[model samples]
Target: MKKNLFFALLLTFGAFATSFAQAVNDTVYVTINRLPVKVNPIASRDSVYAGQSVNLTVTNCIGTVNWNNGLTGGSVTINPTTTRYYVAQCTSSAGCVGAKDSVRVVFKSLISPIATSASICFNESTTLTAPSTCTGGTITWSNNSTGGSITVSPTSTTTYTYTCTYTGSGTSNASGNLTVQVKPRPLAPTLVANPASILTGASSTITASNCSGTISWTKPDGTPITTGVSGSSLTITPTATTTYLAYCTTNGCSGPSASQEITVDSPIPSVAFSAPQICQGDPITITASGCSGTYVWSSGQTTPAITVTTTLSNYTVNVLCRTTAGDSAPKKIKFKLN
Candidate 1:
């Protein structure tokens, strides 16, 4: 049984060897002609400004080569706004096309755009615009603004960056930045007058302070006082109690308005004083009426009636009146001594 098993193994081995030899003889080798054409589309520059031209070249191509755009040359000039894809295919003498080869031309942006800088008043709004040359790509800003333009209300000085993306064919991105300077508003103005209250039709010199800009006045009725005014001071004669406001501006920024109220009172009183004739050694009395104020006489007296001894043939007495509103014009009286 051992001898038979050994003979069977020998037979199996012989059969495998014969089949392998037959397979090797039957195998055939075929040659596939790979296209010798190599497409290498190159641009004159990595990036070009908008409205510029670039050259595309395909090298290592033999026989007649056809480009994607029916262009039949190793090198061709092209003006592509964006990244471009070019395919080059070469044909054999039998009009048979080889394996297609392709090239991607990367276009970089030659545009160095500068964002618009703006100056605005505090709490005010302004618009920031990107250069028009960057319109071909989608614009994105560091402030999360999308598009060529955005409105900004910056509370303080801020700088923003904008980026534009060029997609398809070739992919690239460019960025630009600008600064916005926010100027503070002028200090609030203060309105004041020489006297808080005055008689009717009295002129009050209204003045403005704590201002760092030109000022204009407004009447109580909210109408602008166009009385040829261009400074921080103005005088107004109001027939009744009136309030005035001052508006100040600096560098196109406006400050809070300052206001003051003036009270108008009754007109000044018209009063006169008279002196009585008396003996040379007798005291004299002075009297006044038609006025409401503290009366002061030239005889060193402040009462309504002042008595003084006559020391000369004639004595001149002057009386002055003053009230909360103001002082009145002086009145004089003459007395003859006996």
Candidate 2:
């Protein structure tokens, strides 16, 4: 009984010692709650058209965590115009964890207006204007004119500038320049026989008014007419019944256009026969009427009357006639054989 009690006491003490050692040897870890990230220029920072970049840094971290760019380190570079987010996590030696922080980078552009020119007539005044965004800045005109807008009576090509100022952002400025090209207005052309209508194969003339250069004419079908005619008039001949277009072109500028319609009358030829009915071996005559030109038969006969001997049940004669003016129609004659 004495030996058994001694063994039980040793087992109870051994269990207590093991539990106390484990509790003392365990480690406690610390973590950062949340760190804030910020970009140097806040959000939008306008620069020139060349290019620019913004800097970003991290703050609100008690200790340095794993400075990773999400992959490994905590720093990232990006274009200012582009939107991007920076992520960083904090890790402590005591095994503490922290939330990632994000910062946005943006770019705003401050550039001058592109140079442009407009055409104006002689003795006409043109206004030189700047872009609408050119505000809060004083315009230093290159032509000695002040303010964001300027007026000038230019007989030739002239250039002017407007320097814009942004008082809120110090001496930042944007320049806008414009050129005015002075030119005389083109003279309108005179259309001769304007809006004329004729039959097919007919022609009309159109003249250019006050034109110092060579005149050119374009038909509605995009066919160009010969400009070497006797005078300023252009003769437009249409082969087919079509709407013709006439325009005077000089010095790369075209005048007002005019159109004419040519109606071709190709009426069906009137036909007649000497004998409506004939017996076999009887002679029949086919005639074409109401046509001005010489008659042509399908049987190779060109006379107005063709004498034919009938043998079949019926005979059909077709005559085609064309006038000198290209007016044409077809005629037919039928003779019944009994």
Candidate 3:
């Protein structure tokens, strides 16, 4: 009977040891406010500016709540413009375990105002006003004109606009039109010449009145006669027998003032015979005068002076005068051959 009792006691001791080991490995579920608890991560605010701090609140079940950062806190704040995750684990006195839910943090850009269009012209001034909806910000012009309004002076017809930007909070844009009218000075003086008739190689002068700035002349052939002449009067000479036109120009304005037709006539040619009488088969020399070019003889000879070998006969010689000015005329020489 005594031996049986000892064995029973050993069994009881073994059961107790097993129960203690099981208790050490057991997990305790964390409870909050007397209910099975879950801590969904809390964000500080739905919307906030960059660099603003955001708070995240978490609840844990047991022991001390150990954050992934090795910190113990019921709440935390961070400025995260990037993807971030929060991990919290709870420890219990009974070696139990619990974990808070994790969350991701994301960053976004803030809204700001920007300028859309701006321009300026010469001899004119313009004013620009800022848009009203720009929050916590002021207006600034690139031209050093500040405040909600600015002014600029341009030399000509101009357009002025500016970017409306908000410095802080929210931003927006606005634009205004400023018209500057600068009356340009009257266009340069122009001269118009009328058509006329004149002798070849003669010149005619045309004058313009009330003309400002330098004057220029153009020929009928599209050639520029004078580049710039200070006075209103311009003269052009005709070299050949042709119609000529003259135009007066000042600044950007120009018109035909006058035109003239000139005529050039060829003088008569003088003839001289080598001899008053010539025998058959004898060579005779003939000379012509008042001709400017090669001469053509009836005997098929070409020269200013030619020698002819033939029987006595009457012959006529033709002479042509040509000028560099594109002038050409013919003169006839009559002579007797005996």
Candidate 4:
């Protein structure tokens, strides 16, 4: 009967089909003469992603066709996470199997992407980066720019957004946002040194102003202070003239500075005598001069002048001046009276 089925198939391919039904021992047999069934080597698609389906088609099968999985159909739809083969086996009405073919459907793996970044300071820049996995798709930023990495220098706190779309096999998109914080910068301080002129060994008061916060002092008394005191006022006892500078900073940003100079002076003491005043039952007077300070006399006096009635042939007196800064080191003048 199978031999006759092959002859029947030839006749069907030539023009029309031929079928013969016969019953024997409660078993019935029929014949189907038609074109051989062939599974199309080409598929709806060569490859598909997980949960994605593809159609497998076959043509010209006699009566009906059976897939390897026992499903009966001329076409099959398959969705597999892994590679799969859908085979079609054509059977004749006589129960004789004939002609077989298969098609392969590949599954692709899924991919996801992410973005990264950091914070920044005022006048400072930072690099923002994202994955380059757009895969023939467009990548756009909040600034309406396209690319993988970008540099930004924001004056204040800011937030940026990004999006990546992939058109591979399927449409995929990744999006995220980044924020950069900005720290403020400090301002320069104004300095004022009261009593700009001081005597040697005297202290001068330097004050700071016009700053956002605490101020730092520098260059006091002609000496550089690497780490200085933090305050608005600084008192310095300088032996010589010097310049003082002040400024403030925050978030590693520096501002302009203001300075004040102090001048120091040292004065000598002297005395004025009456060119040897005659003492014949007469009085002699000596006065302190030359320096704007307290005076000391040899007669144990603190006044600037002294009087005496000695009547001695030669009377000598000495004096010195004491200022706020220091005592006079020289000019201890001596005067004689006759």
| lDDT scores of the candidates, listed in order | 0.71, 0.57, 0.53, 0.66
The most accurate candidate by TM-score is 1
Off by over 4 Å in 1: 1-60, 63-117, 220-222, 228-230, 268-323, 327-338
Q: Write the per-residue lDDT of candidate 1 for residues 260-310, one digit (tens) a residue.
A: 887775443344334434557766555665445577667667776765567
Q: Give the per-residue Cα lDDT of candidate 3 at 263.
A: 45
State residue 127's C-alpha deviation in candidate 1, in Å: 1.1
lDDT string for model 2 (63-103, tens) is 55343344333333344444445456665445466666554
Q: After superposition, how far is residue 198 of candidate 1 from its true place, in Å?
A: 1.2
> What digit string (tens of lDDT, one per residue) describes model 4 on residues 159-196?
77777665654554556667777777776787777677
lDDT of 3 by residue, 1-338 (tens): 99999999999999999999999999989765432245556666543334545666665454555566556666776766655676766556555556467766655443332223133323334554555543344555555566765665656655444444433333333333344443343433434433233334545455655545445555677676663333666655555555544544433435434554444433344567788767777877777665444454555565667776765566665655433323234456454554
Instruction: Supply every candidate's count of residue pairs whose N, Cα or C atoms clash at under 3 angstroms.
Output: 0, 15, 16, 0
Name the better of 2 and 3 by lDDT: 2
Error of 4 at 293 (Å): 16
Off by over 4 Å in 2: 1-41, 44-117, 184-338
Worst 10 residues of 2 by lDDT: 35-44
Better of 2 and 4 by lDDT: 4
For candidate 4, the lDDT comes to 0.66
Deviation from truth (RMSD, Å), model 3: 18.3
